[model samples]
Target: MKFHNKKKKSSRGRAKWHALMTIIAVLMVVGTGCSVGFGQNSRKNWEKNIAQETVQVEGLEGEYTLLFLTDTHVVIKDSEVSAQEAEDQESRYPMFVNAEGVPAEEQFPEWIQYANEKKVDAVLLGGDIIDSPSEANLQWLKEQLEALDMPYLYINGNHDWTYPWEYMTDMGRERYLPLLEPFMQGNTAFQRLNLGGLVILGIDDSTNQVDAQALDRYREALMDNRPVIVMAHVPFMTQSALSKAVEAWNSPVVIGAGNFGGIYPNEESEKFISLTTAADSPVELVLAGHVHFYDRDVIEGEKNVPQVVGAAGYQGNAVLIHITGTEN
Candidate 1:
């Protein structure tokens, strides 16, 4: 009986070894196949393009360095990103444009260098990570961010709303949200970062309007006594129906055409108004980058509340902002 038992034990061990080998072989094949597939689909147009100018600015209230990047406007995948290119650097974000557009990749390096020199605590990307929702590109983006020495936050823009809702499959939903899950874990509306005396918030307005719950989160974050910095991709307000109707009719009473702010409030406008009106948070500075236009508005309807716009920091058309505030 003892000899028979020893033989059975030996058979079980051999079976386990075979199973492990099978898994290893399958993984290797899959990895190799993916590599080949990626190489074949590389976009030549993007590889050659580089941004020459840099976007660098100081924070509003506290001594902080903030890097604001937006509108990559194209898909950048594993095949396009060369590890050798940034071997010495901790993180790499390849900026690109589609065919027949102005190139900015070469100028982008200057911005990175400027950030390192400024010693910014965090990097803030104001959305449109991909021209469209490409899994390979999004995954590559996640990996690139993981390499960053400092923490970074991402907001969403209109371009990212192309999730093919018509099909609405389980796989499709999974593919869409998970791509942004890395940045949307804790809060839905905005993320607040408090570094020493500097308070920074990254907000999302891609889908138009802010959720009530998300507004509450931002409100709660402001409970702490520090100057708040708001960063979002789109304007906080837009034209009302009355304003739009006036624009269509060309009424002289309507001033400044339509107000290009925050996606033309309907149901969401009330929530936004409530959030902004509630007890003034330490939000002395507001920075945004959507609409592709350059305009500065002073939001001093109330005391200690200021909002500014910074967009398109490029040659012939670029802007950088500087703000200083006291602990009043």
Candidate 2:
């Protein structure tokens, strides 16, 4: 589907000016002796917010590093839209800024620069890279990701595809598939990338449910006999993450959990969870982001799976994961 692009030059200029003014205003506040905590939020100090962790696989043959980020919530309005739609996009800008009032549009490039500098094996974007499926946002996301020196996998987050005015339904997701297909590699629902000995599996659970087709692909990935790491938008239900999500959002926002005023898994989602958490499952770790906070929990089974939920990228949050295998 073709997206409307009108008044591109003027719209982009306005967006840039608006962002510049925001940064100036924040600097003014900090200069006026306001205790807005600019120390940690300084633009040059954004790297201080990145969190790092390392995982070891018993039979793995080499070491690979990945840069994981999510929930960037980038908002850009470079194409023609309704006044109300433009206002909606503008309203979301402040919601995703760093403490220093730097927007995701600014922080995202920095994150990519870090990945390129570190030369990580790959970049895992857990989803919600854009605030919505606006043409401007999608174009910006594509440009940033394509410029990366290494391969990157991007999954869908709830906000990436749905417009603020539309209800999130299966049909709604299908409507945007063509626009999103270019970044999804081959499949918009599920994707897999093999890094020689370690495999990274990306599944789109942005709608809080996994497609039956995705479950089939997941099973195939499991048969590869390589250590696998699953990445998705929503985190699975674990007691710790559940409690934290409730505390933070005052609702159940996870997947595979029974109905409790939150999203309940459908048959496919239930089966997907069963396969991932099975006693003999080969999933070594799960990485996700949606709760907008950092958390780690072990999904209980005969063998527990470690799950790491990353915080929001708009706040300059990122996770540097080091995967190392036994030496040959």
Query: Model 2: residues >4 Å from true position, as ranges?
Result: 1-47, 259-261, 326-328
Per-candidate local distance difference test:
0.51, 0.85
Q: Which stretches of candidate 1 lie over 4 Å from their true place?
A: 1-62, 77-110, 161-175, 184-188, 238-263, 277-279, 313-328
Worst 10 residues of 2 by lDDT: 39-48
Per-residue CA lDDT of model 1 for 1-328, tens digit only, reads: 9999999999999999999999997687666654343432221322222222222223334445566666544344344434542331122233343243433433333444555565657766666655445555566566666656676667766554344332334664345644666665555356767667666777776655554456667767777766666776655432342243335444312112234321345555455544554455466655555554444553333343444444443221223333344334
lDDT, candidate 2, 270-300, per-residue tens: 8878888888788999999989999989876
Give the range where candidate 1 is weakest over 10 consecutive residues by summed lDDT: 47-56
